[model samples]
Target: MKYLNLALLILFPVAWFAPLLRAALLPIFGMDEISVITGLQSLWGSDPAFALLVTFLAIFAPFAKTLGLALIHFGLLSPKTLPALHILGKLAMAEVFLIALYLIIAKGAGYVTIETGWGLYLFTVCIIVSLFISHKTETS
Candidate 1:
């Protein structure tokens, strides 16, 4: 379990950096892919406050949760810290994933062409794995 958590912890960042969505404005023109970093940057230009909130929830929260889990797993942190970390992890809901899915479906429902990319799937995997580990640790 420790090794699995460690592997996921390392992979999370890689997944975060990958492109999460791709959309084409016109069939003749080309598709533009957006990663989490790029999406946040774009959001910042349009809405700073929203972007900041997303950064805290989608990026910092998960990173912190993973780090906290690792520390607890290795006995670097007391088990007493587990509940706090668990709450933090819960607060780190996968808003980005839901947003991306919404955009894809909503746009596709119209005339736009949008598709989910590997990054979104990878990000989803990270969320699920992290949640699973947290639940397992809590039970054990």
Candidate 2:
């Protein structure tokens, strides 16, 4: 279990940097793909506040949670930190992912083609594994 947690700690950032989504425009004229960072940057041009919120939730929050967990796992941080970290983790909404999926489905309803990228799967795995690790740590 310790090893699993450590492995997931390493994987979370890799998943974050990976391409999370891909879209193929009509007639194959253009193909676009984005990672979380790129997605946030793109959104910034349109809605800065939404983009900032997503960035905080999707990027900063996870990074901080993982770091906090790692500290706890390694006996560096006090267990007292766990409660606060847990709350933060709970608020680390994956709404950005849902919005991306909604856009894909809505667009593909008629004209566009969207592909689920490995990054999305990887990031999701990170989230689930992290949750499990957190629960296990908290309980034990």
Model 1, runs deviating above 4 Å: none
TM-score for each candidate, following the candidate numbering: 0.89, 0.85
Candidate 1 lDDT by residue in tens digits, 15-110? 778988787776468788888888889989999998998888778888788888888899998878888878777766666556666685759666
Residue 113 alpha-carbon offset, candidate 1, angstroms: 0.9
Q: What are the RMSD figures for all models against the true structure?
A: 1.8, 2.2
lDDT, candidate 1, at 52: 92
* The candidate that achieves the highest lDDT relative to the unseen native structure: 1
Candidate 2 — which residues are off by over 4 angstroms? Answer: 96-108
For candidate 1, the per-residue lDDT at 117 reads 89
lDDT of each: 0.80, 0.76
Q: How high a TM-score does candidate 1 get?
A: 0.89
- Please give, for residues 1-140, the per-residue lDDT of candidate 2 as tens digits: 66777787678778777887677667377768777778888889999998888888887776687788888888899988988888767766464466466666757577777666788888877777777888888999
Q: How well does model 2 score by local distance difference test?
A: 0.76
Give residue 116's lDDT in candidate 1 (0 to 100).
78
Ten contiguous residues with the weakest lDDT in model 1: 91-100
